[model samples]
Target: MAEMTLHTELPADMTDTRGLPGVQPEHGPWLRVDEAYAAQIARRIALLDDVPEQVLYLETASQGAAQELLHEALNIMPTLGFTVEGAQVTCPDGRKVDVSSTAPLEALGRCLQNDFVMMEKRGDEHVLTGAVLCFPASWSLAEKAGRPLSDIHIPVDEYTENVARRVQRLFDGVQVGRPLWRFNQLWYQDAELHQPRSATAPLRVGSNLPDGPFYRSERQTLLRLPLSRAVIFVVHTYVLARADVPELR
Candidate 1:
């Protein structure tokens, strides 16, 4: 694993001063690091602070052309919908305010999907490169699938046991990301699903899949869910080494 470090600095005048409503659960903090967007920001800051870490998963062979890797990372970012927001700090007695908004979380997810990394040219070959690791939670996928806040189906009684069991099994061997909405629609549209004699039925999106990364293996994670009527799905990311990509020459 190769490590790539990144640092970004901006002028003070460009800062943002907006604050998102804190996560207030029924009893405690409902969400960690605010929504996906906030979490991404916090993570970025942590990564850049102090001794600063580097993207270590990138193989040296992939680190040949800097522009190539950056371009690729930029292209993949939109797939996850990530943006950066500006932040501003207030005086000693006054409350610190925020004043920027960009969907960095979504972008980070997509970048991670493409395995965003920076490669450097060394001698005649490139090797393990550096990359920013991004793995999104289950809620990010649901939101991507167009599930609304009103869509989450919660019963008066908690089904933690049932939900956890079903999730563990159904999403086994999968990395949690975005639900395959298109695939899910097609699954529900299957002839058997509408047939009276069919034993299997499709489920709604929010009713089943909980928010979190569902891993299928050590190296692979689910990038999308199945297209069936089930709200839950497991999508895995399969990294293709340089050897996997077709030769340009």
Candidate 2:
């Protein structure tokens, strides 16, 4: 459960929306973006592609930072996929050079391919968000192009931690927990654990150990690799303000 005490004075023009963290909330109190934010959005967008199907996963400690990151993620959606063959990228010295796929992908690995962004609302009100081209595992041409190595679903624990670590980097000082919302299962084939459904009859929330490779427990049920290497993503929010006190009744 989220710590209810953390609620701050809702800034003017800011309202909370339940869906899509990176998306602009159309409806209550929302933080207003200033000229500086506008410039940051422009700079981030110029480095992105022209596509729109990309899926952005956004979560932030502050509302302003969340909004800024959302806009920035949208700006670069078009450049995320294979179509960015000859995009021009601007250098720090104001020099423009045609960007190739390799450099962008490498940049992405090192944190630059519209993969994730951190934005600030006022000064220290920071928010971190991530974006990726949400394509079906089989339908994505990029996945097909890359040679298939192993279909093994990285044990859920390992997979989640990999993503969680990246997520941790976005928010500098928070004890981010990894809580996953697991749904339907895919095919699986392993010698140790084999079954269409997981070993537990009904997977209990907060009780089942992190999903992944097993040690010596009888709790595991499913034994199949995920269809894609990248499966679950972690969204985290952090805050620097003093911890909130209980509401005065």
Q: State each candidate's clash count.
A: 48, 22
Query: After TM-score superposition, what is the CA distance of residue 48 in candidate 2 from its true location, in Å?
Result: 4.8
Top model by TM-score, which number?
1
- lDDT by residue for model 1 over 115-227, one digit each (tens)? 23222223322211333433221122212222221122222124354543443343333332332111110111111101111112233322143321211111111221122
The Cα error of candidate 2 at residue 84, in Å, is: 23
Positional deviation of residue 73's Cα in model 2 after best superposition, in angstroms: 14
State the number of backbone clashes in model 2.
22
Candidate 1 wrongly placed segments (more than 4 Å): 1-35, 53-64, 76-126, 133-249
lDDT of 2 by residue, 106-208 (tens): 2332222122222222233222222332211112212222222111232334335455444333223322222122122211111111112232234322214
